[model samples]
Target: MEIRDAVPSDWPQIWPFLRDIVRAGETYTWARDETEESARAIWMAEALPNRTLVAVDGDTVLGTAKMGPNHRGPAAHIANASFMVAPQHSGKGVGRALGEYVLDQARADGFRAMQFNAVVETNTQAVKLWQSLGFEIVATLPEGFNHATKGYVGLHIMFRPL
Candidate 1:
């Protein structure tokens, strides 16, 4: 699979996967009822300067990632990112490839480290993937995420120095 910069046109292909993931209310912190227009705005913002990407194989989009300053003003040196893979492509290394690409982009952009502000504890696949990529769970917010199925689950703050 190859990783590339995402253009505005790519959103048409990305929206379905993004909508499915967010609607599931299982992993991402985005509003479950988010509209396609709003999601498009957010993803496009990520495509600017220090932001997003898409993992593709020729014409097919396998996954996507967005990277940016982890915080504002004084804390901007650190980076942050999010990822999503097409449900059909899960377990095929799309997430891993996207994670690695985002990290490399962050480092190249001069970030000191990368932080995931809210990783749902029950999402074992993501937790494992981040840990495998060298991120450590710095803290876990008690009963942070109200998962649709798991009820309230902890949200982990993961970090890795670049």
Candidate 2:
């Protein structure tokens, strides 16, 4: 498998999973009925100050990630990121590979740290993976997320120094 910068053309493959993930309302904060155009606009690759990557085995997209500053100007040293693995490809280490790549790239780009501002607490796999990667949950907003199945749950703000 290989990971590289995503091209607009790649969205044709990415949309299926991206739509499914967001609509499921299991992780990301995107609206459950988010339109394709709106989601694409947010996920599309940018020229600089941010980037998006896709993981593929040959021509099949396995997952994707986007990374950039957690905040602008004075707080730009802290990078922020989000990832989405194809549902069929989950548990195959796709997320780990993406996470590692983001960390390495952020450090190389001079980011002082990484922060995930709203990680859903009920997403235990993500919580565990970030922890194993040296991230700490610095804060948890009580009943911060409205999980579809779990009703309400905490949102964890995870951090790790680059």
Candidate 3:
């Protein structure tokens, strides 16, 4: 798989997978009822400057990620990121490639560390991937995410020093 910067024209293909993932309400913290326009705006905004990427295999997008300053001004040196892989492409290493790419990009951009703000504890696959990449569970917010099937699940605050 190849990793590359995402352009606005890529949104049409990305929307479906993004929508499915959000609607699943299992990993990401986005509102499940988020409209297409809002999602488009968020994704596009991230693509500007320091915030987004897509993993592609030939012409097909296998996954996508967004990275940015974890906070503004005083906290700007720390980076934060999110990742999503098309369900059809899970287990194919798309997530891992995207994760590694974003981390590299963040470090190259001069970030001092990386943090993931709301990783759902039940999303073990993602938790494992991040942990294997050197992140640690810095904290867990009790009943942080309301899982569709599991009721309330803890949300993990993961961190790794760059």
Candidate 4:
């Protein structure tokens, strides 16, 4: 699969899965009915230090990732990122590949470290993947996430020095 910077033309291909995932309310913190314009404003943001990337196999878009400063100003040295993989492409190593790419890009872009703000406690696959990639769960906020199925769940703050 080829990993590359996402261009405007790619959003049409990205929207379907992006809409589905956000609507599901299982993994992300976005509003369930988040609008297309808002998604573009965040996902395809045209601002400094923000970037979006796609993982593709030929003409198909398997997944995407967005990365940038975890916060503004002096706190900007710490990087943050989020990922989404098409449900149909979940087990194809798409997430692992994307995670590795984001970490490298964060370091290349001069981030001192990478931090994940809120990783749902029940998302074991993601928690495991991040751990395997050298991140540690630095803290867990009890009942921080209001999960759709499991009710309240912990939200893990993961981190790793670049």
Task: Pull out the clashing pairs in model 3.
Answer: none
How do all models score by TM-score?
Answer: 0.96, 0.98, 0.96, 0.97
Better of 1 and 2 by lDDT: 2
Question: Candidate 1 versus the native: TM-score?
Answer: 0.96
Off by over 4 Å in 3: 46-49
Q: Return the top candidate by lDDT.
A: 2
* lDDT of candidate 4 over 44-72, digit per residue (tens): 85765889999999989999999999999
Off by over 4 Å in 1: 46-48
Q: Model 3, range 1-162, lDDT digits (tens) per residue?
A: 889888887787789999999999888789999899999878754533467788998889888988888898999999999888889999999999999998888889999999999999999999999999999999999999999889999999999999
Scored by CA lDDT, what does every candidate get?
A: 0.90, 0.95, 0.90, 0.93
Candidate 4 Cα lDDT to native: 0.93
Clash count for candidate 3 is 0
List model 1 lDDT by residue over 1-162, tens digit each. Answer: 999888888898899999999999999888999999899888766534466688998989999988889788989989989898999999999999999888888889988999999999999999999999999999999999999898999999999999
Q: By how many angstroms RMSD does model 4 differ from the true structure?
A: 0.9
With a 3 Å backbone cut-off (N, CA, C), the pairs that clash in candidate 2 are none
- Highest-TM-score candidate: 2
